[model samples]
Target: MSLRVAYGARRLFVYLVALVTFGAASPALAKEFHVLAFGDSLTAGYGLPRGQGFAPQLEDALRRNGVRAHVTDAGVSGNTVGQGRARLKWTLDGLKKKPDLAIVALGGNDMLRGLPPAQTRADMDAILAEFKRREIPVLVAGMLAPPNLGPRFGAEFNSIFPDVARKYGAALYPFFLANVAGVRALNLPDGVHPNFQGIKRMVSGILPSVTQALNAVEA
Candidate 1:
């Protein structure tokens, strides 16, 4: 072949190689991120259909927003912060792969039970410490106590989540059931948990925080 044609072909090959290399290094390159939604019945979907739970809905929302993530539901009904701490290791051990992000949605049951705020915080701290030790990014979802629980108890109980998140540098979703909490129509018959419509609203409110947590993991 002519030297001119040979040199031109070589240049083309080099350019293609460089392009491929850059593309591989680009952050925009899609990556599959695994997220574990760890919490109580709220995360588990409770009385709703299997597909209608918070994890499934959140996964759909994440995908819709172009995040390549699989959100695993690790919720157990009636799990308090203490119970969550106890089972955390087993839960993590059972995962096929370590999750890039974990969302802690506990404390609802703790609040309902009128558990001591200090004990609840301690349990949460332990949970957060474990995640931090494993270098797993966490997004803590806070739960508020009912007003009937009294202002002093409510304030102390409600502050546990944010305090822990602040201490551990985890992301905080100020209130997991923000838009759905007080709305009578959104709750189940028991009025303590969310119904289908309530779950949707909760998912929507938490999406931004979840997305932020995902970004932290990627970063």
Candidate 2:
């Protein structure tokens, strides 16, 4: 995945979620659905071990729920939305085939660094434009700006996800970390990244929206 991001608006600025991904090849990639989990630390599975990260776990969940899919982890830890846009072209080029759907989750780093929300929106626009140009259906996994940053900042930052999703005609998740944030036991020691059970909660939360997007695009 790209860096870190997901869940819903309430899960913002606290817990992490799946970002888009760009990694090496994997076996049996020829499934009914091919997805790219793009974002930051959440998708990269920063602290967790192999097969426990968002992409792999989500893939397992998808299969368990009866959708045959291979999710590629294309996350770049510490990346901003601009950075995610910077690498999008090459990432797509390097892929063996264009994915059926791309779950794009970014902008948290930009929000954390106190960068302009307009900038994040602009970069997101470019990223989604490219996806549309390439004929790829994208599910824009949303993020809420942390409340500590103040309401104005929150309004500006939070609106970016849905605004871009609407302008680009992408499916919107409205927030990637819906039920996992704010709960102490669900997070890691740093009070940010989710624990194993937390990720499961995220997977469960977003699975329905993800399934809907997949069906809409593939149909």
Candidate 3:
């Protein structure tokens, strides 16, 4: 072959190699993790404007923390643990792909409705079991029962989340509403769902656990 042609071929091969190497190492080429924020109105960003809800805020936070993630809000307002378990399949089917990690944040509505804690625990177990069967990692966002519910009820209800999470070997974010639960300024007028800032607080409180879960998924 002519020297000119040989030199050109060598340069082309080197350029192609560089391109492949860059693609392998580039953040833009990294896997986009899928996270399902499956819960009730809290995850749905009830009373908050677009982009201010838990899912979007969490997604933005993850990106800021140098993680590429698409958080899907599978939350339904007023959804109980039983309802969430029942609709788990439908929600998963609607997703374009199976979630790499799922944040199960139900049972709040069940507590509010004065449902039996045993029932809540069972449904939560079912939900986590489904995710396990699909081989998806999970982070259980717990909910605390109000004092008005009485000590007996509170004891049973509050234990539901941690118990289920332990049983499934899932990561647990002890309380979803950690710092903003009853704060007047953080909550909406109804005092049930969080406002914009409240959602931010929730995302902040759970961000570390989420990052840990994402790391596990990548691993």
| Candidate 3 local lDDT, 63-94, one digit each (tens) | 99889999999999999999999999989988
Candidate rank order under lDDT: 3, 1, 2
Where is the poorest 10-residue window by lDDT in model 2?
A: 19-28
| Model with the higher TM-score, candidate 1 or 2 | 1
Tens-digit lDDT string for candidate 1 (1-219): 999999999999999999899987666547888999999999999889879899999899899998878999999999999999999999999999999999999999888888899999999999999999999999999988888999999989988988999999999998898988778999988887888889989999999998888877677
By lDDT, the best candidate is 3
Q: What is the C-alpha lDDT of each candidate?
A: 0.91, 0.85, 0.92
**TM-score-sorted candidate list, best first:** 1, 3, 2
In each prediction, how many residue pairs overlap at the backbone (N, C-alpha, C within less than 3 A)?
A: 0, 38, 0
Show model 3 residue runs off by greater than 4 Å: 1-24, 27-29
